[model samples]
Target: MLHARIVRGAERATSYEVTLWALALVTLALDVVTTTYGLEVGLAEMNPFVNYLLPTLGLAGTFVVLKSFALLVGVAAWWTMPSKVRGVVPLGLALPWGIAAVSNTVLLAGIHL
Candidate 1:
């Protein structure tokens, strides 16, 4: 029974990790789409780092480089972290990007509406 319980717990953790990582990736994509739209319509980037890269890299390149780096860091964290704290990896990656996506959508709505 104890061994069964341990297996169940591990399965649950695996499922949770997968779900959160999916959420993180989806939000990251959403952020890239919305930010790209915003830039096309003359809205400025709020992130200084992104803003700095904009002129040199343009839209697609900037997102590709930065978001790829972010994902790599998240992967590294997830791989090195303790099981008990693994959820933090995806949550950290998702939350800010989710917020940015929502904010960009709202701003776009205002401009179009």
Candidate 2:
């Protein structure tokens, strides 16, 4: 089985897991929304790992592969990694993601910054 079979109590996410999931979801959602708002990022700015995969695998394929990898990492960290590391992972994502969220909101509101 992928995850162990929970027999007694329900398997629940720890605080770290919850935080990571929330940040990932919010970041992913914001990424989708911001892309539609006349925001363009050059391919050169893309993650080197993802950029390497994009040549052999097209746009949609690259997107799916990257998201799937992220999901697996989150799941693995949630189940096995230490709370401290998991907690730090979300913190890393939050600042940049939060900046993007605020920037996108401002742009959407017609207040160019």
Best by TM-score: 1
lDDT of each: 0.87, 0.56
Model 2 — which ten-residue stretch has the worst lDDT? 5-14
Q: Which stretches of candidate 2 lie over 4 Å from their true place?
A: 1-20, 32-44, 82-113
lDDT of 1 by residue, 36-89 (tens): 899899888889998899899988999999999999998898899767667768
lDDT of 1 at 90: 88
Q: TM-score for every candidate vs. truth? A: 0.84, 0.49
Give the Å shift of residue 70 in candidate 1. Answer: 0.6
User: Roughly what TM-score does model 2 have, to 2 decimal places?
Assistant: 0.49
- What lDDT does model 2 reach? 0.56
